[model samples]
Target: MSEKFRAYLIVSVGLACLFVTSGVGYYGFAVLNTPVGDEFEWSRGLIMWAFAFFFIVRGLVAPFIGRITDRFGSKKIIICGALTAAFGHFLLSQVQNIWHFVLLYGLVGVGMSGMAIIPVSSVISIWFDEDRGRALGIATTGVGLGGFVLSPVLAGFVIPGFGWRMAYIFLGLVVLALIPLVMIGIKEKPKNYSNDKEDDFKSPDFEKNDVRGVFSNLSFWMIVVAFFLTSMSNTGILQNHVDFLTTTGGFKLQVIGASLGGVGIASTFGKLGFGWLSDKIRAKYCTLLSFIFQAVSIIILLNASTLWMVWIYALLMGLGVGGWAPLSSVLISKNFGLTSYGGIYGIVSSALCIGTGIGPLIGGYMHDLTSSYYQAFLFLLVLYAIAIPAILITTLKN
Candidate 1:
């Protein structure tokens, strides 16, 4: 097959996989939160913790997943993950206890380990070398699009009418439906494709990657730490996004869904826009711009009183969310090279999981305590500010 055609298929598979995973796993949970909490008589913090654990397990398993993908292939691993995710989501429909929710979400996390950004970016890195950022931007846009299409349906019609259990089953169906795309489209690039020499990750530095000194590098640590902080803000805000609207702004569920829908639409543009810009400029600067967008959104949320304010928050935060994702793979490839890309990227992915894992609990706890997300949002703003310096201070040389 032509590299061009194969590359297109690869990217299409990635988009579908990422889209379903984020929709059902991340944002779908957003829709399910209030309903699930109400049904189980659980506190917001208690329920959000399950999400926190999912991300934590996803991160921790990433290195192993990355290694496993390298040995066998992402195709089988991803398919298995997809199947596991479907089963886990189906079980979520039958959750009768808190322990079941926690355990089943962990199963979903295992599936995420095989499908999330690290694995998706790793595969993309092996295919499109030159427009890596742009390709990833386009592919990662699936995440936003999923939320765009699903949030409204789940929040507006499904959850309100059929209840949250059916929502999980619906998401499981979505995952199963994507399997053909995965099986047909996802395949590793040939090792020595004549057409791919100028593309793919090994083009510039066509040598085996060494991770011996990765831990001792300051810039590597900076990438880790900086993204950790960024993930805290991003993940925390995402977990409680709809709740903030309903609780603080007094918006209805469908109204909150509309705001999230806007976020999804804007995020699509943000991913493409910033991704293209990253190819033209330093990625870190573009990252800084995303940070600014998110910070402003958080501040707006703190004072959000109407639908317009909610939309404003959603748009800015969506841009930040969408833009921030592609840059991670771009930065990691640029800084660490593709030789140990999976391992290095796994560490970074885990850092993101760690940050996200903790953020929701903290955000939920804050809301539970103060009856508002204002203080937590403010703290996220501070973390964004801290990340600016953290990224800028790192010396990429070495």
Candidate 2:
């Protein structure tokens, strides 16, 4: 490898690692959502809430990992996370009761906490300077790409062929395999840039790396609140996407995989294209563009009665969501400075987890209550409308 592009190698391997996490951990729940319920003869809302609890626990545990990243860095944390996730998946494969689902997923959540967003984003910020946003966009694209590759591969092939039980075991092995690959690839920047004034966000008060003090900043709270709602609304739709499509379109499993995969495919472009723009323009503006796109995607989804329409909604929605994921790191770096990137990002990530937990739980119950997703999607649109002003008014110009 060349001397200058070592960071790129780190980013590449991290992307693949993220792809595995996303495929099995994040999107995997969606693929398994309905089938698990059917096998257990439980209400969809009950199991979906278990998935929601997983994220809540993950969000709560993430800050602790952030503190570890701040003190010791990410290598050990990530390796442990991968190992725990493998074990969690193995345990999940053996679950025979509702508490098994919730408890084992909580264990999965703890593993997720170890492989937290704070550690990964902290490394990216340390490694790349001028191209931070774009590099991050590329790195985080694993989430989408994993969905593209793993979702269909799981839903279309694995789940149907081997049953959900074996699918869990298969995912456990994938995580176990990714452990050494992550350790081999990830590294802190050779030089510490934390003290550099030039690298700092324009916020003068943020030079201290004070976790408690961050909550006092209006801009920081803006990020927390906005992402919280964003996570809640988006994950609701995402966790339920396969079931929604299967019901509405009566499509085959492979076709359903393709539709979900479309989100992943479109998200790759979204991250690459918009992340490039965030470098050229303002990161927050790129964020606004994403919010607009996500809002439009949901509005379109409300009327999606056909398979093609679902694909269109997935494309637009994925793009919008994609922008937010990478931009959070860039925008946080812009607004808060990198003195304590991991902790601040951890808190934001935690808020994101909370929202992620809320979305699917609410969606599941709403589906149970009204036999429709209309209420949940409508709830998100309104939240989007509210967020535009929130983002617009929060000036990064400190």
Candidate 3:
């Protein structure tokens, strides 16, 4: 095969990998949140903790996963991740209690970290240099696409017809199916590509051996702070979205499922749109624009009493959050270069994971306390406001 064909193939594999990992592992969790809670008669906080634990585990392991990708290449790790995540889903089908659920979900988290942005981005960054943003945008669009399809499938068909336990098994099967795709398509970068090349992209500073200096880098921390806050805000709303609509908005399960699926579709467009736009404009400006979409969506959500208003919120929020994954990789590569891309991004992802873990818990806690999600969402908006400056001020001063 030509190098160009090989490059595009890698992107296809990356997209398929995320579609399963985030689809079954991430978005799948949100759809299951309510049924699992309702079945066990657990508090919203406890239910949210399981998700929190899942992301926290992913965060804890992200740095290691990144380093492993740096050392061993991403192909092996991606294979292992597929198996581990599928096993986690299968185990989830047999959970008899909350502890069993949380621990098993954390195991899934470990698997998902392997398949997530770090390794995928590491591989993609090596393939296309100038158009990396567009490549990443297309690859990561799988995340939203998976959610768009899977949310309704779980909500309307799988969970309702087979039950949540069967739903877990179904998700497992979906993940297991990706093994062939990974085995056939995933590959290391070209032999001509050297990760150690700092000038591969135009940045103000590139360090060949400055892995240690990454810790002291101002731009790195700003990215960390921005993503952490953004994830917390985004995840808080997402994890609680179903319950909020069910209890507060008085919507039926089918309607809620449809709305979530619509969000997924909007996010797909967001990833593609913002991803391409990032290459044309400054990634910073594109990111800022995406953030604005999310922030405004939240405002619409706060006042949403009609179904149309909620749908509007879904569209805007999808577009906003969709840009996050690709832009994150773009920003890191733009500023830090790909030499330590895995490790640097791993740490940043760790912070984002922590924020995601906290988000659901905060939303759950606020709901349990107030018997409403209003306060939790308001608090999330404040975090969004704080994150804006962190991203805005981040500059490659090195």
| Comparison by TM-score, 1 against 2, better one | 2
Model 3 lDDT tens row, 1-398: 88899999999999998888778877898889778889889898988778999999999999999988988888898889879998999999999899999999899999999988889999998898878889999999999988877877898799989999999999988887888887888778786876555555534544444356577667778888988998999889987887888888888877777788888899989999988988888887788888888889889888888899999999999999999988988888877777777888899899989999999899999998999999999999888788888888877522
> Could you give me the TM-score of model 2 versus the true structure?
0.95
Q: Per-residue lDDT of 250-334 in model 2, one digit per residue for the tens?
A: 7676676777778888888898888788888887788888888888888877787777888889899889888876888887776
* Model 1, C-alpha of 276: deviation from truth (Å): 1.0
Candidate 1 structure, TM-score to reference:
0.92
The lowest-lDDT stretch of 10 consecutive residues in candidate 2 is: 198-207
Ranking by TM-score: 3, 2, 1
Shift in Å, residue 213, candidate 2:
2.7
Clashing pairs in 1: 129-200
TM-score of each: 0.92, 0.95, 0.96
Q: At residue 227, what lDDT does model 1 achieve?
A: 87
